[model samples]
Structure formats: structure tokens, C-alpha cells
Target: MTHDLLVIGGGINGCAIAREAALLGLSVLLVERDDLASHTSSASTKLIHGGLRYLEQYEFRLVREALGERERMLAIAPHLVHPLTFVLPHDHAVRPWWLVRAGLWLYDALGFDSSLPRSRSLRRDDTGYQTPLRQAYRGFVYSDAWVDDARLTVLNAVDAADHGAEILTRTGFELAEQAGDHWRVTLSDGRTLEARAIVVAAGGWTTQAMTAMGVPPRGKLRLVRGSHIVVPELFEGDHAYILQQPDRRIVFAIPYPGGTMLGTTDVAVEDPSDARISPEETQYLCDAANRYFRRQVSPAEVVSDWSGIRALYDDGAGSAAEVTRDYVLELHDKGAPVLGVFGGKITTARALAEDALGRLAPVLGFDAHPVSRARVLPGAMIADIETLARQVAERWPFLDPHDIDRMARAYGSRLIELLDGVDSVRDLGRALPGGMTEREARFLHETEFARAADDVLDRRTKLGLGMSEEERRAFADWWATAFPAG
Candidate 1:
């Protein structure tokens, strides 16, 4: 069967584009080489902000667009994307107080329609609740949003599937050739598909994908590696810290579920697969955090670390940090129409998808209307997540409050659907470590395209961090026995 669109890549942008196209009445097929969001999409700093530091580079356009998208995402996915206050302590040596205040003012002005509170100045006493600073200094608190990045990608894929798009995970696009008016594509699994148009949103692999498809590279691609480290909690509050480094770069210390998430270093890499956080990068992050907070961190304190490669459109920038985070869509009409996606951030993926479809509309002969602007993602139908969690706790009085909270945050309104017809803890099936049950695991495998234990414990949820070594071994044994390798 011929599809109207064939999307190659299961990252947030590709999934979002597929959902948007499917909702626009197009028959779509999306194929992912590995699990959805297993790469760069999962390895993010996990913030939905306007890139406040970008204002320094005169990237006002990107910041404004991202700020608007941030508002829209918060409105639709309140459960996963909620407001997070950022405390930027003024370091006179790094940036002057007046300059910081001006930037905050501009940020607030740009996000005029934002639901979050505007930025505010804080005295030393006012900042006492956060990690103790080495010295007394003024600070500013501004608003942004946090997200379960992997879950966001999965939700988009789920929504696309619900809207009649065929999603194929663990399937690789091997080749493509023009056949009449459509492109005949071959998959690694020996399956074939025909589509009038193809969208390549392969993240770091964009250049490789285009090269493999015999399409000439439209622009020079630079692979910049961004790394993050997770450490034990450093503060008491939910508010995050944005620390300015001597190099004029910024590192964020966010309040993660199990600890403080600190990151990220921008280093130019040669290969996309070489995205491992180096020892020097880890030390740099620790030193950056130690320079601000009185609670010093060492490489030994790192519980876990991850790195993602950004395939950016090289604009002759001097440093990787100076490269543009904005996305570029290149349309090639040589064979069947194909669109190659360049650089983009998670916060602007929805907007990027909208722009991509608008550009492809003329080539594909379809009128693309804005459909996802007011639509809510799957599992985000609940308006107030706290109220829904309370209701779930009330319904299941025997369940642990912590378990209920985790489930509600991970599944949102879909928590009910996950636990449908189940009563009591035993009904949930063998309780794995971190409150996950066999029932929930099976649901993720059957519905959410979770293939392995890591897919469940690491990406889909961070329950792995809370699991004991023995508990993880037991879960692995059970998973292998239940769903062995194909």
C-alpha cells in the first residue's frame, strides 16, 4: 500500500511530525531503527525553556518561538510538562548584575503570554532555601518548564498511531529509490513501502541518512556532544539552579526524581555514535557546580551520566556553544520529494514539525492546517494531575502513596487505563522493585513499544535508579523468560 508520508526516525521531531501529518488526514508510516527516543531524544537536559542564554548570541527569534512552544506544551501536558523556577545567582566575576537583570527583563518581555510568573530579584536571605552559596550574592528567579523527554516522544508516537499512522520500531530504513510518482523504500526486515514523500528527522544521523539515500548533503553538519551527570540531591526545594561558568557557558542543576541532574558540556565530536561523556567533561561539570554551590561535587558522586549528539547546521560558528539550535529543513526534489531536518531542540519540536509540514504541503499537494496547537497529547487529558493522583489514591486505598504518585506522573490520566479492572496489589502481578508490576510492564511492551528491560527501567521510567542490584537481576530474569529475544 502507498502511504502519503514515510517518516524515518522515532525521535521527538519525527514522531511529532507523523502525528501532525496523520491528524491532517494523511496516511503515514514511521519507522525507527531502535526503540523510540533511545538516542538523543532520551539524553536531554530535560527542560522546556526559551534558552535564556541564547539571547546573548542575538538568537531572539529562536528564543521567542521556543518560549511560545513552552507555554503550549505546559497547557497540553501539565502532568509531564510543568513550571520550574530557575534561580540564577549573580556572579559578579562572570556577569554583571545589571546585565543579568536586563536579560531577565527581556526574557519576561518575550514570554508575555506565559502562564508562569515573571522573573524576580532575590536577596541573599531569600536564596537561603537553595544550595548554600560559597559567598553572599544576589540572585534572580525565573520560570521555565521540565519534561519527561522520552515519555514526550513516546506519547507523540502513540498519538500518531491512534490517528491511523503505522509506527514501526526496531525497523531500519535500508534503501530508497524513485519508482514512478512514489519512492519505493526497503527496510532492514525485508519489508517494502511506497510513499509520495519522505521526512528524515534522524537527529544526529541526519547527514548519514541523507548520504545513504544518495541525496547530496545540503549543508555542512557539525556533531556537537552534550553530556549530563546525575548526582545526589544538593538542595531541598523544587527550584533549579542555573550556574554561570568562567567560560561564559551555563550549567543547570535541576531537581531530578532521585537526585540533582547537572550538565552539559558542548564538545565537537567526529562521529554521532561517539557520544560518551568523557572524564574531563565530567570533572568540568563537577567543578562548575562546586564553584557555585557550597556543597562541592566530585566525579565519584556521579550516579549516572548520559550524552547526546546534536547534528547542527554549521554556520561557521567559532565554538560548538555558539552554534545555532534552530532547525533547518532542506527540500530535495531530485527524485521523490524528501525533507532533511537539521538542528532542533525538544522545546521547539512541535513548532518544527508544523513548519516542516507547511513546507512539504506544496510538494505533497495537501493543505496543512494547524491542528496540534490546541490538542492535548495522549495521557495528558487530565487538567490537574494532583487532583487525578488524589482520586486514584482514593480509589486504591491499599496502594502506597509513593507508588501512586509515580504511576500518576508516568501515566497521567492513563493510570486508570493501565490499572483497569485490577484491584489490590496482588492484581498488579509480581511487584518488581520500584513499585512496577508485571501488568504495567506488559502494558508498556504491548502498547508503548517498550522492547527491553532498559526501555522500561531507564527511558520509559527512571525506576532503575531506585531498584536494588538483586531486584534488577530478578526483573531481568523474568523479562527474558517472558519476552525472550526474537
Candidate 2:
């Protein structure tokens, strides 16, 4: 089949672009080498906000656009994206008090249209952030958002499929050669596709994908690994903290279910695939948290951890921490047109899709009208999520309230379909730890493209965190038996 557009990569940007183009009346095909959001997209700090720290970098335009998209996400996917308050503790040794206040002020002003509350002055004892060793100081409080980054990517892919786009996972785009006005593309599965225009939105492997298509690298990326450690819950509040390191780098300690998600060190690396946590990075994060909180953390205390490559655009900032988070889309028109993407934030992925299609529309002879923001993603049609959760709890009284709440966030308005005909626990089929059922696994496999166990446990939901080694093994055994190889 000759698709109008063939999108490479299945990260946030690629899925967003596929959804937008499919909505624009184009015959589209999106191919991902592995499960969607299995890599960098799933490993995010899971915040949906304008990079408040970017204000110091003077990236006003990028921050403004990200804030706009943050509001858009709240409108389109309210169930998946919710407000999160962050308290920034002032440190006289790290940065000037006036500078921190001024930066927070700019961060608030730049997100002018944000429905979230503006930044305000805060006291040392004002919130969950505290320490016995630290001296007296002040801070600021503001609101951003938290998101299921992996689900957001998958939801976009689901919406694209609804709009008639062919999505193939475990399908790699190996090579492409010119075939008159179109490109003859080869896949890892021995399939050939004809595409009028190609869009490369591969996250970390973007440069290499460009090389395969016989195009010179148009953008340089500074690969920075961001690592996070999950430790036992440190504070009681729902709020998070933004800690300032002496080296001018900022780390975030957000609230997780069973633990506080502490993170994110900016260290440079040569390859994007080398996304593994180091002992030093773990200690670095623990120290970053211990510096603020009375409860000290050790590497041995880390229950779980993750590392993802940033693959940021090289703006000649010398250090990887200073590199720009803004994305660059380069187009080449030698025979068939090709568009390449690099370094985009999760909040602004929908906007990035619009920019990508705008470049491809003129070349491919199609009218690209904008409709993604209006056409809301799947599982997000409802206006209120709390009411929906209440309804689900009432309908399925057999289910636990906690399970209902988690499913409400993960599946949104689609919970009815997911749990249809299940009036009791027996109907839910074989049960696993963390409230996972065989029926739920089947639904994920059939609808959400969750083929493997981790695809359901990790990306589909964070249920894996609560499962033990024996519990995980039991689920794996059932999964292998239930869905044998074709």
C-alpha cells in the first residue's frame, strides 16, 4: 500500500504526528521498532508543565508554547493529566534569593494562560519540605501537572488508529530508496511500503535513522542521561520539591504511590542506547534529596530506579545541562521528501505534530487543517474524572476503590468497555497481585497493544511496583499460556 505518510519512531512526537496527520485525511502508517513508549517516553519524570527551570536559560518562547500545550492537555486528557503543586526551597549558598524569586516570577508570567495557580512566597515550615540541619530560609510555591507519560503516547496512537492509520509495533524501518515521487521503504519484518513522504521522529536513534535514509545529519544532539530513584515515601503531602544543586542543576522529588520519586541528574554520554543507572548517579540523587529532607536516603534504600537519554539539541552550551530542550524539524527534498525530528518536550508534542505536518503538507500536496486539539484523544471525552470514578465504583462494587481509581486514571471513560460483563471477581478470571486480572490483561492485549507482560505491568500501569518476584513469575506463566506464539 502507498501511504501518504510513513512515520518512524513511536515516542510522544511520532505518535502525536501520526494522530494529527491521520486526522488531516491522510493515509498514514506508523512503524515502531519496539512497543510504544517502552524506552525514553516511559522513563520521563512524568510532569506536564513548561520547564520552569528553562526560564533561567532564557527560553521564553519554548516555555510559553509548552505552557499553552499544558493547558491543552488538561482540556483534552483531564483524566490522565492532573494538577501538581511544587514547592521550591530557597538556598542562599546555591543561588541568590532575589534571583530565585525573579525566576519563579518569570515562570509564572510566561505561563500566562495557565489555569494553574501562580507562584507565591513560602516559609521554611510552610510545607512538607524540611530538615533539622538546614538553617532558616524561604521559598516559593507553584502548580504544574503530572501525567502518565507512557499512556499519553499510547492514547495518541490509539486515536490515530481510530482515524484509520495503520500502526505496526516491533516493525523497524531498515532502509528507504527513491521510487519516482514516492519512497520504497523496507522493514525489519520483510515488508515493503510505499510512502509519499516520510517523517523520522525516532527519539534517541534519530540520527542513525537519518543515516539509513541516506540523508546527512541536519541537527546535532547532546545525549544526556537523566536518572531517577524511587525510595520509601519521605513526606506526607501531595506536593513535590524542586531542589537546587550547587552546580546550577535542579532535581525534582515528586510524590509516588508507595515512595517519593527522587531524581534526575544531567550527565553527558556518547550513545543514546546506554541508558542505565550508575552507582554514582544513584548516590547523587540520594544526596540531592538528603540535602533538603531530615530523612536521609542511601543507595541501598532505593526500591526502584530508571534512566532515560535526553537526546537534546546541541545549542553549543558546553555542558549537557545547558543544552536546549526545544526540538528541531529539518526537511530535505531530494526526490521524495523527508522530515527529521530531534529534541522535543512531552508537553509540546501535539504542537510539534502541527509543525511537522505543515512542512509535509505543501510538499505532499495535501491541505493540513488543524483538528487534534478539537478531536480529543481516546478515553478523555468526559469532563470530570472523579464523577466517572464514582460511577465505576458503584457499577463494579466487587472491585476495590483503589483499583477503580487507578483504572480511572489509566483507562478514563473507557473503563466500562474494559470491565464489561464482569459483575464479580470470578468473572475477572485469574487474579494476580496489585489487582491485575486475566481479563484485564486480555483487554490490554486486544485494545492497547500490550503484548508482553511488562507492557501491561510497567507502561500500561505501575502495578509492577507492588508485585513480588514470585507474583511476577506467576503472571508471566499465565500470560505465556494464555497467548502463545502465532
Best by lDDT: 1
lDDT for each candidate structure: 0.89, 0.87
- Model 1 is weakest, by summed lDDT over 10 consecutive residues, at 123-132
- C-alpha lDDT (0 to 100) for residue 379 of candidate 1: 82
TM-score attained by model 1: 0.98
Top TM-score hit: 1
Each candidate's root-mean-square deviation in Å? Answer: 1.3, 1.5
Error of 2 at 117 (Å): 0.7
Candidate 2 has a TM-score of: 0.97
Tell me the tens digit of each residue's lDDT in model 1 across 64-165: 999999999998887889889888888889889999999999999999998899999876667454436777768788999999999999999999999999
Off by over 4 Å in 2: 124-136
- TM-score of each model, in listed order: 0.98, 0.97
